[model samples]
Target: MMIGTLASAMASFARPGVCKAAAAYHGPPASNFNLGRILRYPNLIGCNRSPTKKSSAQLQLWRALTTLTKREGTVNGPAGTRFSTVADGVIAHNDHAASRIAASVARRQLTCTMGRVNYDVVVVGLGAFGSSVLYHLAKAGLKVLGVERYGPVGHSLGSSHGASRIIRMAYFEGLQYGPLLKRSMRLFLELQDELAAVQGPLSEPLFLRTGMLDVGSVFERALCSAQVQGLQHEVLTGAELNRRFPAYRVPEHWRALYQPDGGVLTPERIVQAHVGLAQRMGAQVLTGTTVAAWRVEGTGADAAVTFKLVPTDATAVAASKRMSYSDATATAVPRNVTAAAAVLTPGPWIGQLVPELRELCVPERQVVGWFEIEAAARSHFAPNRFPVFVLEETSGGAAYYGFPEHGQLPGFKIGLYRHLYEQIRNPGDLDRVNRTANAADEAALRSGVLSYFPTAAGRLLTSSTCFFTNTPDGHFLVERHPRYPQVILCSACSGHGFKMSSGIGQLISRMVREGPKDTAAAAATNTLQPPPPLPPSAPSPSAVDRHVVQGLPQMDSDSDGVDWSELLPFRFSPGDRPGHREALDRFS
Candidate 1:
């Protein structure tokens, strides 16, 4: 009888245009499926066994199905329900094919959508990482919503707003990222193919394989990583480097590691692609909407997310005159959104949302300067002629990185890694205006040019400032909130996260769907593990006594076999400690 009532509710929802036509259709009528029907069928509701348990489970299931059907606009066949929808709707679910979902619901362990919870996951911050997470989640048939604090292009202050970010496989950081990096590369290639299918072959390239070069002792680690991960690379002495690319004067002592696989990533395009794919897959993306506050109500299976939202920019609509003043006023009205699970990928603004992590990850203002290249040397720095490079000083000062000429910029884009930073006290008020290239910035970059690429050193053309949300250990913080397991924290990429955004996004999506298991896999592969210090007798990477190569978090990868426990979130005592050090030791 309980199943019969469920079938009746399904039938009632299948009535075409009945609910849409009604000016105010509150819910299904009593004739459809009412509480009285369930009360009458005592035995069917398991009153013969644990009455309360069976009744509660059935009611919850019934309510969940009704809510889902209402959102999906169709009630599928009885037991083998097939949930399907077009762009910007709900996730498609085929219960028969995916038994895990049905079994979860039957076991009463499905906390994703309980009473009143609308979406399975609400992603805050629709930048590169957030957009990717939303796309993957929506593609997996989960009701997902993406909320961004800025416009569709994202705020210029964040790291994901640029036209280009470097992608490399020869990681100098450590070997742990090997597997994840390879996975990301594959996904990126797949994304390109997917885009080609939809937008035609002539569509602008998403990823350009221009190759990459590492000009520092850190290349030793890269060589090690390449060897361990079966990645292809070439070792070049300074003489060989100068012979291959005439753009720069390689010092006799400086050796370099070259990887043909490294290339440039179009960040803005990637974000847009993710957002586009996600929307097409029925994920709702809300741009220019700031998440004012979010809190979890209840706990575990009964938990729900309640968030207050406000417009990130109000004057834009009024200035554009797209709507009347009355409509503009309505746009500013605050909205309350509820979800089963919420992912906070706010990037630099993460600390503001979770105060406990404020100390762990701090946002720093970093600059990228574009310098003009002479017509004579332009051909030398073209995508085919020269590869992207990360050059370091012999005395262990700040490292500098730059890319070959991509179409977006009129000049060669270059910037110092982790240097030239100002602490961002407030994530909202990032100094976007006054961050133009000053004399010091120009002089510093020119000095490097004079020392290395002498011919291409031209005037500073343009510059932009972005934030680097850095952690102390430089590892990513992709774990659950200490207090709220329903709330996941997925940000603080330091200065080297954009390249890994694709893989990180996939891992994050998996976490939302599979819970602990996905999170463990991601954490195991992605969490930072710095290489052990080398002995003095070890041969220097540069083969010169004056030069030194320091390792840092640069690339991302994942391995096949993983010890799930090794990737568990840091344990913490139920106290007011910073990182829950006592409990975090469990993973350590």
Candidate 2:
């Protein structure tokens, strides 16, 4: 990296820089920027810390460019550096400055800074779900607007940054996820066609559906679940498992359940594509804008929860590094702001948004790193030959999952699930989870992987952590926002929800446009919804029953993140009479 680029970067921060205008905004930063710490994302400390050597080298290159520029004084032609390539200062990668420049330029190019008008719908949190919601809303011809705290396609934080995510047909998680997964497959195909036709940035067809294994010492539930759902699958014995994937050295008692129609999904790219489609369809997408609260007015005033907006500044970026946040310089309530339908998908921030979910949503810091492997073994990890795997009891203690080698993330990609840092009080507050691993933690995880793939362990190359928004029951939460019919919330994906994103987005649009006729939309969607408000002193729905919500694993005691208002705008009480007709008219 060059000093010149560094100087330029710092210099650029001057000029009355455009600071982030939101009290709560998010996005990725210079390469390994941990905005998760800023957003108090649940498990940020897990995946987004260290930078790859490649990023270091890039920084050095920038510095060198700056020096050359100074030495040359002024030049019309080659100053040895030009802002044309994808690696130029103008085209920032993980750098906050670059993301800012990119966002700034995009705003100008797309006329993004125009005055905001009203719309029918406003979407926030553009990860997997928000982006898709925007696309469908736009396609359905609704005046829609979207606000993403991160830069275009996401600021490079959260569980969505990775190259590939596994997609499967026979979900072991349960049949509840089967329909959505299947629909997502269809949407992905549709996306491929739509993107190819647009003839712009090309996103090719997704990886082939080779298959996947849910190899666990004590569980065959995934296999059974698939069978019960009538999905095609196979339970391979010791020899069969080894034969299908020789690299896997399964123990005698251990076996593998293979879902042949399963494969990989381009996770990060999926976010970009959906949002891109939405924007192209005329949905106003404001990157680097946070959803500061809003005012839900009207007879549908139930949509009263207002979302505030904010932009990024230099100090804002620096403070975010320390995992802190500043207030927004400016704020606006979108014209289409949904008083009701808010999808709270703050990946690791489950603790922040719905602290009650703390019990259900354990904020475990997890990591994923690439291991360099030989060519022969590459096939064993290839998208076609190598089935995406979630090996639970690999003679190696590591209960991890892996995808085919893609991009620079080396080796047959592997990551340990149990090796993750345990639950913390909060993901953002530094004092919470133990980002630093103790000897026991390392040994536990290391021993786990080492035990199973003895040779593979030796090849381990890189590692990074990610948070899981888990549901105690290991399902997902795609329900209406408590106390409000217009607001909907989506969260708790357990460990795997990236694959069904296309379908999830579709359902969001379907529900917004078609109302409750969107039954398949609900099944295809997963989340929790709170009942409408009752008279004061009324017990919470769970309180009236004297029993906790069932199927949930466990919950935290000090969960202040859940919206704890005395009365919901229009909560959904179990015994409450049907108010769907009125609600539909308002939303429609």
**What's model 1's TM-score?**
0.73
Candidate 2 Cα errors over 4 Å, as ranges:
1-117, 200-202, 301-305, 312-342, 350-362, 374-376, 394-398, 427-448, 515-588
Q: List the global CA lDDT of all models.
A: 0.61, 0.50
What is the C-alpha lDDT profile of model 2 across 1-588, one tens digit per residue? Answer: 333344444334322212222112243222312221211222222123322322343334334443544553212333322121111112222245444543433332211111221344667667777777778766654555677665545444455655677776655555455445555666776686787777555546544556778787524767655554454567788677877776667675677788766677766666767777666555676655554445455334222334666563333233222111122321343433432234455566555544444554565666665655656565665666567778766344547777766654666656666454465556454223343444555455455456554435554465544556665445555656444545556665667767767767766665564332334343345343322223334332321022222122222311111221211212332243243233334334
How many pairs collide in each candidate, listed in order?
11, 83
Residue-by-residue lDDT tens digits, candidate 1, 356-433: 666667888777777788888898888898888888765367588887776757877788877566677665555232
lDDT, model 1, position 99: 33
Q: State TM-scores per candidate.
A: 0.73, 0.61
Best by TM-score: 1
Q: Report the backbone clash tally of model 2.
A: 83
How does model 2 score by TM-score? 0.61
lDDT of 2 at 485: 45
Candidate 1, which ten residues in sequence have the lowest lDDT sum?
A: 84-93
